[model samples]
Target: MLVYVLAIDIGASSGRHILGTVENGHLALEEIYRFPNGAAMQNGMLCWDREALEGHILAGMKKCKELGKIPASVAVDTWGVDTVLVDHQGTPIFPMAAYRDRRTEQVTDKIDQRRLYALTGIAHQPFNTVYQLMATPADVLERTHRCLFAPDYFHYFLSGVMANEYTIASTSALLCAGKNAWSKEVLCMAGIPEHLFPEKCNMPGHILGDLKKEIADKVGFNCQVILPASHDTGSAYMAVPARDENAVYLSSGTWSLLGIETDTPVTDEAARAYGFTNEGAYGGKVRLLRNIMGLWMLQCVRHELDDRYSFAQMAKMAAESCYPHTVDVGSNRFLAPASMTEEVKAALREENKPLPKGEHDLFRCITQSLAVCYAQAIRDLEKLTKKTFTSLNIVGGGSNNAVLNQWTAKATGLPVYAGPAEGTALGNCIAQLIALGEIPDLPTARQMIRKDFDIQEYLP
Candidate 1:
C-alpha cells in the first residue's frame, strides 16, 4: 500500500504544495499548487501577508481533496529567522517583519556580540530573531505572550498548537550552542523575555496534533500535522543523497547555505571569525554552514530587467558570454539594494574593474563570481571541519543552473552533483513518512533518494 503525504515548502519568493508518495520503494512528487510569496511594504515597514499565505495554504489542501488524494499527513517548511509574536489570546501583536527589514540594524550593537556567540554559537546577523526582538519597542515586548517562528505560526494555525521546532529555533540565535533549548543568557543580554518563547522546543518530525476541525473540514481531510525540520534549508539538506559522509551539502536557492553536517557544533574562535553558523538539523545533528548571498543576485537582476528575460534565457546567455571582471557577490551591500544591476555596476566601478557591456555579460559575471565564492567557502569548510570534502552536493532550485554547476566544479576542483531541485519538499515528505513508520530512518531514506531522483554530475 502506498502512503501519501503533503509537503508545503515555502521559500522567499514562492511556495508550493507537493504531493509525495513512496512507490515501488522510491519517492515520487507531484506539485499540486504554487503561489508567489514576497514581502510587502506597509506602514513604512516590510511585512509578510500572513492571512494571504494562510488562504493559499487552505486553497492548496482543498485542491488535494478535489484530486481525490487526501494525504495521511501534512507538514510545512519555510525559510528561517523571521517570526511572529502573539498575545495571551494567540492574536498577533504586530505584523511579521520580513528578515530583510532594516529595523534590527542597530540592535546588534547594543548586545555583547562575543558573549552572545559564546552562548548560542550562531553567527551574528542583523535580521536574526534575537536582534529583531531587541529592536521591538519596550511596550510591544511587555504585551507579547508567545513567540512563534514562521513555520511554527502556520502549524499553530492549522493544528491549534503553539510550539517551536528545534531546527528553526536554531536559526534565531536565541537557542543554546549545544543544547536543544533556548539560551537564557543570550535572551537576557538581548533584553528579550524567556517567557515570550515556547515553553519547550520540539524536535523535527514531532506530531503537533490533528488538524483543527474547521481546517480539516475546509480541506476535507483530518490528518496529522507534523513538523518537518521546519526550516526549509534543514529539509533541503536532509534530501542530500551523499553516499559517504565526506561530501559538502549546498542548499542553493535565494540564499546559499554551504556546509557539512556534524555530530557536534563548531563554536571555536576560528569558526566564529569565518562566519560559520551551527544550526540544528534532523536527529540532533548540527549544520555547520556559512550563509552566502545566492541566486538573489540573479533574481534581483531579472526584476531590474522588468521581467523581460526568463531564467533559462539568462542562463543560456551566461554560458555563451565572456566577462572577465568579477565582484564579491556576497557583500552585504547587495542585501536589499534598490537596484541590483546598479549595485553590481557600483561594485565594479569601485574596484576599478571593467564593467559588463551587456545583460548577458552581467549575468556571466554574477555566476562566475558566485562560483568563486563557492570555491572559497569550500576551502573554509575544509579548514573548519579538518576534513577535505571529495565532492559537493548541490540541492534545491539553484542547482538547476548548469552553467553555475560546471563553473563551481571547475573552480573548486571537486565533483559536483546537482539535482533534486525539489529537495526541500522531498525532505519535508520524508519526515512525514518517518513519522508514519513508512520509512525506517534518514540514512535509508537518503539511499532511496539516490535511486529515485535524476542527479547530473559534473567532474572537475
Candidate 2:
C-alpha cells in the first residue's frame, strides 16, 4: 500500500502543501500547492490575514482530493507566539495580533526580569505572546474563552478539535519552559488570568480525531488530524539530516534560528545575559538559540519597492557589488523599520559607516550582516551547551541563498551543509507518518530522509 501524507506547513511569508511518501526505505516529497501570506494593519493594530490563509490551506487540501489521493493524515505547523482568541462556541472573538506588533515595547521592562528568567528561561522579546497578551486590553482577553495558537487553530478547522500543543505554548511566556505548564506565578505577576489559556497542554501528535464527516466527504482522506511538533522549528529539527554528533542546526527563514538541542533548560544568568532562549524542540528538548533579524529586512524592502526585481536577480547583483563597509543589519531600526532601504542608509550615516550606493550593495550588506549573526549565534550555542559542534547545517528557505551559505562558512569558520529547503513540510509529513504508526522515533525517520534527499556541502 502507498502511504501518502499531506502536510500543511505555513510560515509568516508563505504556505505550502507537500506530499510525502515512504517507498523502499526512502522518503519523497512532492509539492502540490504554494501561496503567499502576510499581515495587515486593521483598526490601528497589525493582524494576520486569517481568512485568506485559512482559504489557502483548504484549497490545497481540496487540490489533493482532486488528484484522488487520500492523505494518511494532515497536520499544521506555523510560527510561534501568535494566536487567536475564540468564544465558548469556538467562534473567533478578536482579530489575531501579528507577533511583530510594537505594543509590547515597554512591557518587557515592566515585568520582573529576574523572576521571569527564573520561570521561563526564555528571553524577553517585544513580540513574545506573553508580552502581546499583556498588551492585549482587558475587554479583549476577558471576552475570550479559548486561546488557539496557529497550528492548533488549523487542527480545529480540520478535525473540529481544540487543544494547545506544548511547543507553541512554550513560546508564549505563559508557560514554564522547564516545567511544561502555565507559569501561574508569572501569570499572577503579569496580571493575566490563568483561565485565559488552555486548561491542559497536550504533547505533540495528540490525536484530536478524524476529520469531521462533512470535511471527509468534502475532501476524502482516511487519516486523522494530528499535531506535529506544533512549532515549525520542532518539525524542522525532526527532519534535520545531521550525520555527526556535533552538528548544529540553522532553521533559517523569516527569522534565522541558530541553536543546539539540550536535555535541560539553561536557567543561569550567563545564558540570560547572552540573550539565548530555552525554546521547545523535538522530544521535549530545550532549543538554546538566539533569533536573528533575517530576510524580513530584504522582504520588507522588496514589498515597499513593489517587486522591481526578482530574488535571483537581486542576489546576482548583490554578489557582483562590492562595498567599503557593512551596515548594522541587526539594528532595531531594521527590526520593523518604516522603510528598510532608508533605514539601512540612516544607520550607516549615524555610525559614520559607508553606505551601499546601489541595489547590489544593499542586498550584499543584508546577506553579509545576517551571515555574521548566524556565526555569532553558533558561537553562543556552543558556549551555552558546552559542546563543540562538528558541522553546521542550514535548512529552510534561507538555505537556498548560496552567497549567504558561503559567507556563513567564512564567518563561522565551520563546515556549512545546506539543503532540504522544504524542511517544515518534511517535518509536518513525518509527524503524520508517526501518527499512523508508519515510523517509530525521530532518528529512524531522519535516516529515511538521508536516503531520500541530496544535501549540498560547503566547507570553509
Winner by lDDT = 1
How far in Å is the alpha carbon of 319 misplaced in model 1?
Answer: 1.4
| lDDT tens per residue, model 2, 310-423 | 777767777898864666554566777788889888888888988788788888888888887877777877787778888888888878888888888988999998878888
Model 1 per-residue lDDT tens digits across residues 270-298: 89888899999999899999999999999
Model 2 / residue 253 / CA error / Å: 0.7
Each model's lDDT: 0.91, 0.82
Q: Which ten residues in a row have the lowest lDDT in candidate 1?
A: 191-200
Considering every candidate listed, which one attains the maximal TM-score?
1
Q: Give the lowest summed-lDDT range of ten residues in model 2.
A: 324-333
List TM-scores for all candidates, in order.
0.99, 0.96
